[model samples]
Target: MTQHPTKTPQFFLTSPSVCPYLPDQQERKVFTHLVGDRAPELNDLLTQGGFRRSANIAYRPACETCRACVSVRILAEEFAPSKNQKRVLKRNSDLVGTLYPAEPSSEQYDLFRDYLLARHAHGGMAEMSVLDYAMMVEDSFVDTRVIEYRRRGPDSFLTGEGEGELVAVALTDEMSDGLSMVYSFYDPKQEDRSLGTYLILDHVRRAREAGKPHVYLGYWVKGSRKMAYKIRFQPQEHLMPAGWERYQPD
Candidate 1:
């Protein structure tokens, strides 16, 4: 077998642990360091192949006898928001998004804490500390950015932006093929707004406006309510044996 120099790249596997989404299934991941000149290319490929990046590592769920986690990418250029999607867009009309370097701020941390407590208090990321949040946002080799969504103020007409508290944020990775939404959080209190869906919609717009064809949305695990939402973005591509194939809702 022809071996690439990356074969020996630092590798490790997580000990069997409780799966956050599944009731009784345990989960584990085998990961490798994503560095060197090929890191960007590898990261993009990994993302398409159903892996997610954390800090400097790109890893995927390698559960025994399980293939439930599927990678999904939104075809941004071809995206046409459904009637409900349009509602989500109009719902957050008062907000403006600013793209900034992937640096964590105390304000961001506070919002993150509130989000976890309200939405995923029982999930894996609930115990993450402020420093952990910083590493999650700041530790990266490939280009990363933070989009902060706030309310519009008086100068909103000139800037079309807001000066109110940050209501939502997305940590994204800029790739050659698309913008990978690494992670996103929003004010959970505004349940009526469905801000999570709004962020995904916004990224779809940003990706299309930037001339990118796809918006990587990480993995969508079967039967996982937390991930089922990814499937709603129609005309997306799901990685399969023959490579990315279009997935249209039934």
Candidate 2:
């Protein structure tokens, strides 16, 4: 009989780069590769420790002087959508979300490109080619899935899928505790629908239905207006210096 030893993950630090969330600030990250059979377990552990996944890498902010990038997770079991969020849900009620294997489609790429151009035209992912997009969706080694949102067709009730044009797509990782939204993109033309808020609301419903406790919303940076949306999902816990504690804004 032969015995094998478990390998420990290796972590690396990134060089400082311009912080996208805050002006006149630099950002650094501590990251590790998430690969092999241990990927799912590793993902669960690292995510709970405040790391976020990109491709097969798990990373968390490691700023030397700033600790503003706080990790947030919604308490799905106790979440109550506010009036505006409820309106977002009602507005998107006609759409149906179907979970699919994490495989990229041309349709998804088209929507992704449109989203980048309209929303992040000068950001890092603006020049991403089709191959890059494919890698983003298909390079995962853990329990990942793609949820596509579209209009509910007549037969949607039977199949639990949607029909017509693809409205939005979410690349998600199903961890032991909750769902982690890796990335999502939608039709920029449908801005009136408030798809971004709708997406998180839908995830809250999903996490509760599946008996999951949290919906990891990644880093919520203080002073970043873009991140203000994350704080709205109340009764959430923030990963603090003392550990996960219910957030109470001062």
Candidate 3:
């Protein structure tokens, strides 16, 4: 019998780039590749330690002077939708989200392009081609799923799938503890429906139903208006320097 030694992951630091979440600030990250037979286990452990997965890489902020990117996870078991969130749920009640294997489709790409054009026209992913989008959805070594949102069909209950055009899409990773929302986008024309909030609310419901304790929401960067939506889903825990601690916003 041959015994193999466990391999330690090698991490590398990214070059400083202008912070996407903060003005006049630079951001750096330390990342490791999440590959091989240990990918799932490694993803779970790294995610618990504040790293977020992109493709097959696990990364966390490693800025030199700023410590604003705080990892957040919703306590799904104890979460209750607020009045506004409840309204969002009600507004999106006609829609159904069906979980599918992490495979990219032309329909999904169309929706993705529309979302980027309308919401993040000048952002990093604005120029992403179909191939890049495919890699984003398909290049994974961990447990990943794609949830597509669409209008409820007359036979939806029988098929467990919605009908018509794809209104929204969510790329998620199922970890040992909870679901991690990697990236999500929706029809910018349906802004009034608040599909973004509905997605998170639905995931919370899912996590509770599945007996999961928390739903990882990546990072909540302070002072970033884009990230402000995250803190609304309380009672969540923030990964502070002292470790994961409950956060109660006043």
Candidate 4:
């Protein structure tokens, strides 16, 4: 065997695991590290190429027989919140969002654990310990931020940060064209407000306010209700063979 450069990117495959979105299905992922010298630029390019980052690894669903994982990005300037989206906005009007460094707090971990236990009890991440949570939040080579969501207090208007308990959290990345929402979780108990959708909507606004052009919404797995909500944020773009293609949903 010939010696090779250690800097050359190496990819690895994860053993088959239970698929979270589909029942009786197994999922496998092929991933590579997104670190070293060019992480930020690599992240932006891979994002356009349909990859999402978890920790410092950039990956997409690499299922052999399935092509359900389609990457979705919102045309932030052209996006119009539907009536239902507006309703969600109205319902969550009392919540405030604050962006901070990618450092984990016990408060956040409590909400995260509760979100997993209450909402994804049987999910793989259900067993993630606080150390695991810290690794999730802190492992990154590119710019990443955690946006904390909380209910507004009576005096919040007078100050800025709210007083209510944390209700949602979005681990997001600031990209060249927009902000990519890597993952988001919310208080399942507040199901009526649709906090997840509200979080994405808030990111779109944040992207626009920051003068970004789109909001990368990771993967939209067909027939997965968990991923389907991504479509309603139109006019959106989907990665196509020819390149980014604008689409109108039925």
Candidate 5:
């Protein structure tokens, strides 16, 4: 019998760039390709160590002077939605989210473009082309899925499929322990619905129904207004030097 040797993933460090979440700060990332036969397992291990997946790459902030980016995961089973979150859920009750295999569609790209233009016009992904969007959605090696939210039709209960126009979409990774929301976008026109918060609430529900323990919300940078909403999901655990510890917000 022949034994196969274990292969180690090659990690690389990115050059410093302007930090998108904070002003007057430089950001660097330590990343590795999540590919090959061991990609899923590697992804789980790295994610536990504070890495987040983007397509086929797993990266974590490696800023030399900033320790603000903290990995966060909601304790789904213990999560109790606040009044505001409940209101968000009620607002989106007419919408239904259906999970689909990791595949790209022109509809998804259109919404993504509009979202970037409206909310993150100067962000790094603002200029992503259709091909770039496709790569972002489909170029993953681990267990990934795209959740599409649309208006519920009369027959939706029977078919488990949403009808009407696409309102939002979330690119998610199914992990051994829970689901990781890699990226999410919604129709900018429906800002009043607070679709972003609805998406997170939906994921928490999904994780609970699936008997998953956590729902990874990526990095929450302290003092970053844009990331402050992440802290709203309470009973969450943050990756600390001693391992994941319960976060106590002030």
Candidate 6:
């Protein structure tokens, strides 16, 4: 009888660094490469285990003392848009989202650059060049798609595609259970449209239509003002040591 060897993923730990979301704190990460024919399956499993994918890597916070980062996922079937979310949807009603293969474009990079410069000038991604942006969008082994949000054109109803300038872009991964939002960016000039929140709401609708139960939203740091927006999506599940449980913040 031939025996098949069990393949185990190799993980590496990063050196301690200043936490980006929290002050007076340090952060470390345990990450492994997501490659090979099994990359998609591995990504889905790791994501369900509280790991997040970046490019071809899967990483999760492994801080020594702080456990502030919590994985969150929205219950797509049960998600009800609040009054404010409804308003956001109505505001962006003229926009349409079309999913495309994982390919990079100059227009997408331009918007990404502008968003970083305006909203995250001091963040690490501020230094990303066009090439870096391409890698972020296309250097993936899993089943990934780039959804471009644009103004609805005259023929949009016929083609189911958007036209005109790209207003927002979401890099997402299709998993067995749900859609995992890897990263997203939007035109800062359209702040009143609340494009960020609208993107999440759209994903929930997309997931529900695809028969998916959840929409992974990455980590929600408890004390980070920037991360506080994630909690606004109610009826979400927070991955806990016990298991994923309902989280309704007070």
Top lDDT prediction, candidate number? 6
TM-score of each: 0.92, 0.96, 0.96, 0.91, 0.97, 0.97
- Runs in model 1 lying further than 4 Å from the true structure: 1-8
Q: Per-residue alpha-carbon lDDT of model 5 for 1-250, expressed as tens digits?
A: 1122228788889999999999999999999888877889999999989999987888999999999999999999999999999999999999989999999999999999999999999989999999888989998888999999999999999989899899999999998999999999999999889999999999999999999999999999899999999999999999999999999988
Clashes of each: 2, 0, 0, 0, 0, 0
The 10 consecutive residues of candidate 4 with the worst lDDT sum are: 1-10
At residue 194, give the lDDT of candidate 4.
Answer: 86
| Candidate 2 weakest ten by summed lDDT | 1-10
Q: Give residue 161's error in model 4 in angstroms.
A: 1.7
Worst 10 residues of 1 by lDDT: 1-10
Poorest lDDT segment (10 consecutive residues) of candidate 5: 1-10
lDDT of 4 by residue, 171-205 (tens): 99998889999878888788899898899899989
lDDT of each: 0.87, 0.92, 0.93, 0.85, 0.93, 0.94
1-250 per-residue lDDT for model 6 (tens digits): 1122226678999999999999999999999888777889999999999999998889999999999999999999999999999999999999999999999999999999999999999998999999888989898888999999999999999999888999999999999999999999999999999999999999999999999999999999998999999999989999999989999688
lDDT at 7 for candidate 3?
74
Candidate 3: global Cα-lDDT? 0.93
Q: What are the per-residue Cα lDDT tens digits for candidate 2 across 179-216?
A: 99999989999988999999999999999999999999
RMSD of each: 3.8, 3.3, 3.3, 3.6, 3.4, 3.8
